[model samples]
Target: MTTSLVDAESVLAIEIGSIHTRALLFDVVDGQYRFIGAGRAPTTIHAPFFDISEGIHLAISHLQEITSRILLEESRLILPGKADGSGVDQVVLTYTAGQPLRVVVMGLLEDVSVESARRLAASAHTIITEAIGLNDRRPPEAQIDALLRARPDLIILSGGTDQGASRSIAKNVDLLTFALQIIPREKRPEVIYAGNHALVTPVKDVLSTYTQVHVAPNLRPEIDVENLSPAQDILADAEFHIRSRQIGGLQSYRSILAVEPLSAPFAFARMIRFLSRINNPGKGVIGVDLGAGNLIIASAFQGNSAVSVLPMGTGPGMAQALRTIPISEISRWLPIHIPESVVEDYLWHKTLHPTLLPVTTETAAVEQAAIRQVLWNGLNQHRTRYPNTPLLAEPILAAGMPLTQWSPQTSLMLLVDGLQPFGITTFVQDAHGLTAALGIISTNNAILPVQVIESNAFVNLGTVIVPLSNARYGTSILKVKVEYEAGNQISLEVRQGSVTALPIQTGQTARVHLQPLRPITIDPIGKDTTRSFKVIGGVCGVIVDARGRPLSLPTDAARRRDMLKKWAAGFGA
Candidate 1:
């Protein structure tokens, strides 16, 4: 078994989305890991071919042609390579195409355990069909009726402190058992007991007799403290178990997978946690995976982490986003003055032709405009659900179809104008979907993730500096100075409500200094009146977003359009 980064000479990572399945290849060059090539094919989990392995094989076929490497042996993969050179040493997989998991949460109290269960559901793309608790006004029989009506795929039973309750939990469990008996034996939802530790065996014994039972650590160890990571792990496992069977296609490739297949959103969230642990501990790390149908916002701060999976994205899977983000809101991000009706028509047309690439600049701009709105909507969802999780983070990472489909500068500006994050941070793009792959690979080979991440496996969008102040619009806000490694130096000033970029190419390094003109804070900590740091070059150099904290666009349509254009020009998009 490969236990370290150096042991693997070739790696193949696959991410299967609803619309597309992408195969990315990474290999060692001069004793260091590098992204070699990638291939894409339409996902075949639906319609005429219900097997996803067909899509996976086709993608790898393209990868073979691209690199002139033999990766397949007829119908099966050529694993562990051959002495004559044809195949990979390891293969990893992630997917985001399964049906959303439906859940029924039952707790002792409404605000304590029940709320925590809801948060757990929010961590993944799950629907809470019913929330039952001791505080529930309905009678026990009515609660049972509700649970059976919901027909949840999984039931989360959480309540009481570590050793607080026995009788109350038993009462709920007895009621749950009766409800399970009511449903057909094959239709019973799997149970997850995350309540008092003392009842673990009893809960499992009774529930396992009816259906599968998963035990997780107490979600609420104490009244004031909430522990969720372990429960989240169980949730992800249960989701994988439930969806793997639902898809049917995964069964064919399940035996050959290097590790257990992981849901793309859950894998992406785990990746964010790993990245956050290694990143700035005080600020936090936020990563977004905007897939074809769903978008996930994963944030980790200090020791706490939050994940929100929303039904929002670029093309075909935008029904939920449209309900919230109006045509005018999308138009606000467009540089051209297209009418709201026209913009809506374009989006509807794109939704129908989800795979069609934009041929005209107008259509592309409209698509990007909609993308900004989706990003904005996702950010708002994160803030609303997990307010305690800080948005001030370093290296805001973006992934999924939108990032890969658009230019780097376009992705950067959409993130800036949509997320509107404050303080100084770096912007990174996961165009290859390596973040999830690395996270999954780290489960077995811990060193591979660190080495590959430090290598050129991801794109560097550059450092983003946002100044916060109470200065009037158009007033000078911050002064920047850059001292290049070769001894060249320059300084500039930026006014409030505007954006600008510094000339720092990729693979270059410089020492940067900043001073707020009107006593603004550039870093997460408010005390830094002056700041200096060594920075690296990226696709877009140092960005000074003097656009202030709560980026507000002009009320007039034309004015907002021009302002959006100015920001795009600033990034040279």
Candidate 2:
């Protein structure tokens, strides 16, 4: 009998990213899965070494040296661990190195089918260059010209309910067929028919001659319910196949893996879904990864998740981010006065050399300021997708430079300043960059994720209590009394527009009694009601942010710098 994936003792996980290639070793020690060692090397997808496997090998070699184990046999990863525990039992791969999928969505309705297609595209890290709707005013020739100009890698055709209209659907299909004919056969984009099942055969018959056509279950089968998983799965598989061919030697990389590789953003969405399902019920989970090349925001609520990948990040995306946020907005987060021109220059330099670390306080401040805006932009985009979902009360997990490279206090402050959570919320950081890898691992064995999370794979940044109110800056916001360990009591006062941190060490839990003054409300459970709850502490302990809703900074440059300095001091950043 084959051993179950959960019973497999050792696993080797690799992540190939735009900037770095990381390898991690996980083994079942003392009958539980735990992370053993890790290694990272600069990605070799560019110039001299175009093959991604070169960096993978180097990273694995570093891991072998650290763990004193042989991972590669004849330049290929060893599988099914030897009797002496010399090799791993499984290998999992994930990557974020190639260009995002360029997708064109064609639908009849903007709200129903088009919206569904857009959500699927976002989850797959696709850049939607063109969306053709029935109500579009563009002429047929204009639409076809635009589609050809866009040069999409894939086209998603979704419209019409189960037994809905057929004339409009046929017209759109005819338009697509004509467009596909004009493009060269070798360069024609693949087609995914996710419209009415009744039209699948005719749709396939029309497009199969010029391009490969895939039939997915209708996205809006009945108009009231949406079954998007089938279409999303197809899109993910198509994306993986297309990307594997684009990235040299990635097909060989896939052949050596235990299972098919997953896109980093898709894997992240899976991880957040798992975390949200098992860890917190009723409340949602939010995850943000602000990398040098891309910014990814994923959220999970009630077992469903959505992901948004913005190409605006710390490196190449910095230029795009600068266009979105003004220089003065970024300057307000800096503690010291720096000229806007100098700040702009530094950002451009970073775009040229993304891997360089900030050695000076000024540079670090600039990077943090940019990070704040990146998070702000990402959050706004997320809210646009999930308008009614409340992200402020969800548990947040953040990764990348701003959180991993800074002090715990500084990282926490950046998150607080950027996210501005309301009510009671938990914050954690992916210090080791293992969330995506673990997400892929979880797909093979459900039990492994629980084991790894329980083993402290993430750094807990502690819980924050944010009261929703608008009051005078100097007035009292709330009074908190903590009772812990043999009835010891500590009383603390939080004033409006101020942040207070209480040191409560890891592995300790405290019972907190919160009394909000008049006009102030603790929105976690109820409004303007005194509440008593238990909270856990982590590296930075519990933080009480009495900052008002829609946090504002001073308009004056001098005062803003001074206020930012005070805020940084308050958090011990």
Candidate 3:
């Protein structure tokens, strides 16, 4: 993902979401890529304005106003920025158009070929409606019935390896061909064959009789090796067309873009690959973008990642979340006892007025409660897709307007409550929501995302330390001495079930000494026996969460509310 730009000096990226559309400008500053300016507007993709270009124009025009440099004339962008800096050198697109594409996956084995196919389909913006492998016990009739019942928009068939036996692969393709005949040609779903290179011709020749078939590279060319990028590229194109037609056709907005728009969720999921690749040893990266209509959960370790895009969120999709998240789960996070009916009513009202603000303090608390559960639910789904990332993630990032409404401290508390990260971790906020734009555009210019990441483009929310201990609540487990850059020192004795922030501020550096009284896991290395290290401070400074792993919140509602308060107060939230 690291490549230097040659001709392009100024680049403009447009990010379209369900509720908003953003335009971000990046240029070489002091011989390095840096985010220069940005503009945003309410997305006009529905109702009174069906053309996506309206929002694009508004955001770009706003960018022109901010930079005093014109990027558009009439409805088109001025490419190859002039010496006067009145335009940009290139333009790119990224957007979260709508729902995740429903897909049915079939392969030779559930854990091998089928699992690889499912990963290709499970981008942040895709949902696998059904998965059938040779291991599946259902009869041939039942398999066909299940495929039809799924009502998928796409079917991905993958099995076998390069030059491997083709009997099972051929059998799956034959079954898929039969299933397509069951549905009318007009209603038949598109198909993707990413199995053995040897079987592509036969699979395409058979499935192409019903609907368009795309032959992607073999997803599993070797038994022990896995590669999905080639197939993921095809999926991205399918997603683009699948979503573009839903909002005033793809060509309607094509003129405003220098290139075709990339799927936002997939771009974000792929971005984790870059993040996880650059991270320090022994830690992974986890990121969640909770938007009004969608939620993206992605975690990556050593370039392997799990990403899921749920079609619901805190705004327009609040009520829809109830389908996956239990009603009881949401109320448990509330600080005050509120009837389940009241919470249900809140979800309905939020769905109607997605941008509605809290009317009272109680309403505000309830809204936070719902958001916490939505994040928790998103993580739960992500865990199911890939569970090998890491027990603790470094720089766990939280993105979306829902989190921006709260202070960094409050957001960190929500992260602790929602993610329940283990061991040691750091947290940051994608405050400007430029992650999708940066991630997708990296395909064109990789320097942009890396440079922007190193810059203060993201808000650092401080590091969190969670020690593994079985000591009872209120018992001291870890001792810490925080020495700030300003020559100030503060010592703390953290007890079980406590969450607190040490004395430090953003941009400050600190050398910390740690002593564990109980059995705790802190990676040990080097010559010194002392567990001391230098750390950077965020808005909330260094955070210590002594809460038990698999976090045990109080069973009683009243006690849980009190515990939440004490935790919040510890950060001065």
Candidate 4:
């Protein structure tokens, strides 16, 4: 019986995240795996000794209770094994890291080489601790002092290409050797060199003599393009391995599985590639996933792309919202009048104690504020990072658990407002809060997650022909027209960070074009060109030509709120 139980068909895939621990039960039905039941518990990361198992066990215990109840209540007519309710088979546990892994970049130069290393570190979700270089004005003692303060988990020593310059690279090696003298052996960070391959042996001789050193292919073997895959893989391996050793509880067991620092972003990117490449190779799409600790932004245009993670999350933003912004700011969205200090205290407590339930009316109000602040912060960060990138032109798909709880109006408002800040007009969401879970599904079972995301998870915000030239704050330059079939046309002026509502009903198509105020077209990198293209609507609408810099809307609190109100009124939002 015990052996038979091990081979049972039902299985549970568990994901333990910094904010939430979830259990997803899967069972075979009609020769296909179907979702059974899911249970969630708030994660306890700051608890004594950081025992991850305590949280995992609690999550699983709830799952068992929920599944048993579901079977007893409903399985009699719908599922097999109704008598014993022996449907669950196995468990696969995965986790989202709580503490961010740090990486110190030791490059040959400050601007060129260090910049490339910084980009790679950003993509891998590694917090950069130190950026040391040969020409850097800082002394070796200052550099070492900085590294010691950071206490990074790993160091990425990168420089010149395969057969390129070696003097600058050697300087970095010498500096690292000096730093190693003061740092203890056990506490010393791991070093990864992605530089001139020829200097790898010498670097090992100097640096590896004191610390554990690994080598990967040069990040920029040539001047034009960079090859960071091998280095990225090595970094991920080192992060997970080191984290597994120090973090107690479930992480120790979970580290055995293949995990990456950008696991969620990578999962989303793979899904898009699988879908687009399989059917149409010339596909361009975008994906965004917002969570408690981080917000992931990924985009693919003309088959190649970049994905990034932002550190600002809803919980922290909400807590800070009270002190930084006005409580009346949040209450404006709420129906009833709530005290400022009450809301502030509620948000603060929620940030410090995320797992607790909102037991009172004020607490609920604070939750709304926190949730709104979270979405707002993410959009703000995206706009700041990719200032040249226009949001309204591209369909930005957002997936998150909070989106599931929001009323459609509130959700729509948040989505529209968030995008309005960046000029993102169109929106998509997994209303069921299933995108992250589906990410795991796409990994284990192919094609299914894509189908589900396409069919149920994503929603089209709307289509509008946003001229590139008019993609600036306070500039309403180009005119937009959606020509419907019955000689009907809807027109609106282009406004940054605002969505125009045309009465084009669902399931109907319209022709969209941008009558640019200036002769303009936008390149794939979002730069304005002296050329123009016919308007097209897909994930991202046509990249119209624009003259001025990308929208530089104000971030001043009052000014922004006023601008937001005006834009919201433009769409009757």
Candidate 5:
């Protein structure tokens, strides 16, 4: 006997950000999941409403008006759908508005278990205020003082293998317990033990009296292996629990969710992992979200994934982001001449008023410059964390207001100049900022993500071909021929140190053949060989960049402006 299975016919996913609350509707159409519609409203976590539910209801009301569907009944979400097709079958929520968890990591070895714990913290939206290791040369009194001053929300105690050392682990636990005793009971940090399993009971006994105690699998069970999923999961659960308790209306919001709300960064990371596993073999997927106060960079290869959350962004965190890179680094991307002081002032003003959009071309240019720096910082952090991961060669998904608010040309240029990937790569933007929403729904039901992604949830920005070479300027880098339907053909020569774009509408496909000149590499396999491959068109069409590896930009004032103008014209920017 065979059993029949049915998928949820209708679903509503909501994402509450620091400034905006967005809702997306998906329904099964013709036996496939499809994105129905989306609506957004200013987040009401603060000010007049002071209730997140208000913003969610308003956003859903907008969706109801758009689709003529009744999602809310008496200020409550209608669940399991209605016989009249007026409700949804399920609802999921994700958020990124609350303060990041303040965490302190304690480990035995600085490079061993300590490093693994640090990587786990990096995977979530957290601020590592202090990390204590056994190698510290400071006196125990001073160390305890620093730990007490940090005032962490949680403590991650990890050291020792499954059956390794117990004496040293007890010593570290003793120190942590003493520190917790000094603090008030209501203010003590929760403890998560991810150390030797054999000592979990003893460790809990020592710390449980001071605060809540949770246990996870050892982060470094063996010296040769680093198991982070267990720790990552526990950390995310703890963060949600703490956030729901601290935020004013989130506790009530939690009661309505079918499942616990997930952090935006965690959900986004999972979505990237799922996409990387399903699509693209032997490569990885990179998803970047540049929020007002945070930047999330998630990469997934096969089934392994890593997320790096940088606390600096365009709004509340802009001042810190500015200190990381020099003013000249951002000014180089601006086509027009702007003084460093003026650029600095613009960033300061933006930090004060993040919702303000660029009103003029000059301001727009400055905004894009800041975006480039943010992307650079995100990519740099990814590289530092996962040095051996493959290049961002697969489809790249970009989110956040900066990319969505700007024209496709300008957004694409900013990405290209910042990442500078070689070979063939496809770039796409999260058209409706549904990455986190889709990710949460996908976790509950696997078929939903495939359905929504197939329904054109993302806007394809086209494929780019960048040849890696260091040939002299003005030299012929490669000869390209593009053949489409009806025997139409376009043949052109791209020069070294130049950026060129070819027009191709979205949903169009072309057969591209490349013949590289001597000492020039078109494909990643061989530098001096000819290559042929099929390419897809997008809103920004096809861009062929032969601007040698390291992507040199002219330093002289006059020449730099001329070069910028030429590149901008090529991309219709």
Candidate 6:
């Protein structure tokens, strides 16, 4: 057998999200994947093809332009007067579809299986089109009609334990059959049964008669736990196939040594999960990908054992911020006061023209607020979709276009603190929003990315210490000891109802430990006297408690403004 020689040169991977398309060249320097020059451009989805090839071309062209400029500036440093050398070795293009793969959940009970199904889909970043179950009490025809109208890409059918509850499973299978009969033959959806194993063959036979049918092990094998791997993989594969068939110009992508274009993001996400788990076990990790048309929120919890994706994006946020919310809300968050009508006009223009640059400072502030609002809303929706998971020292990982222009305060409020009902221990941002690109590259070439993530690819923004005594709301629960290296120690008791802020500037480490003051009764949503936690410094930096409990929007406008201002000031935002 003859073996082909591989070149040592770098290969460039380009990722096109719903909003922005980016290109990054990667080369192994000192056996590490170092980022060479990069380029970016707007994604193209309005065109007839929605193929992603055209967007890739625009991104590559931008990269070429920027590379040319960089080479021109650095030419004197190198001999032989070379401005451009080899250009890009190879181009790998990956994209996320603007349209989410609508998901339908069929299960036994609304609480047991339906809720778990919602969490699985949310973690996968897929959309739930319809959630139907035995308790739902909707007629077979109603469920079928909803399925056909939604034209979901895949159906996640779950019910019963391994040998428990057959009526719900049988009923759900009948509903699947009804749905397949009504949907067009060519467009019949894919079905995955993660339910009772005894019914798997029945499900396959019923759905295979008219649509694509797949089966994974029961998601709720026991009443207590959820096994999502098999189902998630099946759903991810179906999504790839569906997008590949629909989005044109994918044939060019199939020629790559490995991976189809549509499947690259999933592949990348899986790789990140693998690495994150290996490094930080049982940590809740979240990644925010902000695109033009849609924003994808990917989250992983329990040592990367779980992941979910959300499709709400800045495009919709910009539109809603400009129209749905008042100009006064926008003004309150602005750095400097401006006319409400002027802000309205600016936001109106932005809503109509989604891609305009913020030319003035006032406009820039408005854009920042719009970004914050979008993230806040998106995170709220995320929490609601998947609730009641204890967050333990989780790091919020965010990558987006807006992050490239992220201010410290905006980053803190929107990223570090936004959507964190529990509390975020650290906030890490990908400067180029190219995690997907890195993710895709890591599949075949895993070493580079493995090193990158291990070696400071993520910046730690101090730690957040939360004191918990399992106490009821309004209880004085615990005491915290914070030891600073600068020869100072502070002891504080956590009080319920009021959020205590312990200031910790960036680059200062505090060692903090907690001691429960009393055995406190726990309240689900309300604050008790024992609701207090303490702060400490660590190897990373001083700990702060920015946990704004009693999740509520500022009701009094003036009071809300003052509170926000105080929060901003306290956090050094």
Clashes of each: 0, 0, 1, 9, 0, 31
TM-scores of all models? 0.94, 0.95, 0.90, 0.71, 0.95, 0.74
Give the per-residue lDDT of model 5 (tens digit) for 120-205. 88777788999889898888888899899899988888989999988988988988978998999878888889999999998888
lDDT of 4 by residue, 1-573 (tens): 223212235545667677777766665444444565677776666666376666655666676687773432232212233436553433455456565667788787676567667766765445687777777788778887888888887888888977999988877787788778888888888888888888988888888788878788888887655775566556656655666655576555554333232345555544444433443233344566666556666655544555566664555434434555566555544333566667666666666765566667556545655555555655565445434333333445667665545544345556544443232234555554455555555555554454444453355444433344444544666666667666777776654444455445545656654565543343334443413222223332222222233333454656654654554444443
- Which pairs clash inside model 2? none
Ten-residue stretch with the least lDDT total in model 4: 538-547
lDDT of 4: 0.57
The whole-model lDDT of each prediction reads 0.82, 0.83, 0.80, 0.57, 0.83, 0.61
- Order candidates by TM-score, high to low: 5, 2, 1, 3, 6, 4
Which residue pairs show collisions in model 5?
none
TM-score attained by model 5: 0.95
- Pairwise TM-score winner, candidates 3 and 4: 3
> Which digits, one per residue and each the tens of the lDDT, describe model 2 over residues 15-45?
9888889999998867778888898888888
Across 87-106, the per-residue lDDT of candidate 3 in tens digits comes to 88878888886556789998
- Show model 5 residue runs off by greater than 4 Å: 1-8, 47-50, 523-530
Off by over 4 Å in 3: 1-8, 130-150, 178-187, 220-229, 252-260, 486-488, 523-530
What digit string (tens of lDDT, one per residue) describes model 1 on residues 322-441? 877777778887788777888888777766777778788888888888887888888887888777767578879998877667788878888887788888888899877788777777
Model 5: lowest-lDDT 10 consecutive positions: 1-10
